[model samples]
Target: MSVVNPGDTVPSAKVVVSDHVSFEQFVVSRSRALLRTAYLLTQDRHLAEDLVQTSLAKWWAARRRVTGDPEPYVRRIMVNEFASGWRRRWRGERPTAEPPDTHGPAIEPHTDLWAALANLPRRQRAVIVLRFFDDLTEADTAKTLGVSVGTVKSQTARALATLRIDPLLKAD
Candidate 1:
């Protein structure tokens, strides 16, 4: 048995060192995926970067308790952060000018889909992202959003209904 004192520096090769390394690897391996999810949720590159950074910093501080897979926990942080901010300021960008013609592939199909997604309400957007994009089950989606499965079901139903009727996606 050991009595850890406030002023004592005991061992250097214990949980902290290993946990730090694991957390660093976690950041490297998952940052891109997290950023993509964040971009989908926030619909802005700058905001997505900020959200991912903020979520990583948060998870790092709580690394001790973040055992097993950390992606879900980090995702929960990003989603909650976006949701809270959404409740405050509800605005997103709209591209007015069309993309310049080039010899590359065109992204016509995704444009309408993204536009329709952007118009969804906050909870509905989160529900759609987690359920469809992330491919989490309804129970997992409910757990991540801190809502009931019934709420997730209803939000998904409503969001899908709205998307199905959107003029932009209707032409797709």
Candidate 2:
């Protein structure tokens, strides 16, 4: 049996009763932040876009369950999906090799910052992004990661320590 689309329902049907806000409005408001965070996690613009679309689809499908400040919720979903994809790759015990030359000038690259972020374990990177980029409080970040506040504190210290050697930030 075919599942019915929203418009297929009879007139006066309540597909979304909350504010009657269309999906387009929500996407327009949140796409940039979602895409940026996805890029940071996936490290590829195209992949980041796919990640955001996947996340948004999931979020919209479960729209009634979420209310107020959905950004963190969606970000968490994107991160989880990214980690899941990484696990599916066949990169076991790979050798250290030179990175691609996407770091050349004219990009205004935050090479040090990004390299430092990449060095972090997945959980730590997620925490750092939620705490710093998302400007979420420690308690909120912990909630998003489903970890204790103590874990956030420990992970943040470790990530910042790794970044401290960047030299760009040392003089600042």
Q: What is the TM-score of each candidate against the true structure?
A: 0.74, 0.69
Off by over 4 Å in 1: 1-21, 86-107
Clashes of each: 0, 0
Deviation from native of the Cα of residue 146 in model 2, angstroms: 1.0
RMSD list, candidates in order: 10.3, 6.7
lDDT: worst 10-residue window of model 2: 98-107
* CA lDDT scores, all candidates in order: 0.77, 0.69
Best by TM-score: 1
Summarize candidate 2's per-residue lDDT along 9-113 as a digit string, tens digits. Answer: 544433451584556666778789889887887666876787787777778788788887666667777777665444234345343542333233432246656
Stretches off by above 4 angstroms in model 2 are: 1-17, 83-109, 166-172
Name the lDDT of candidate 2: 0.69
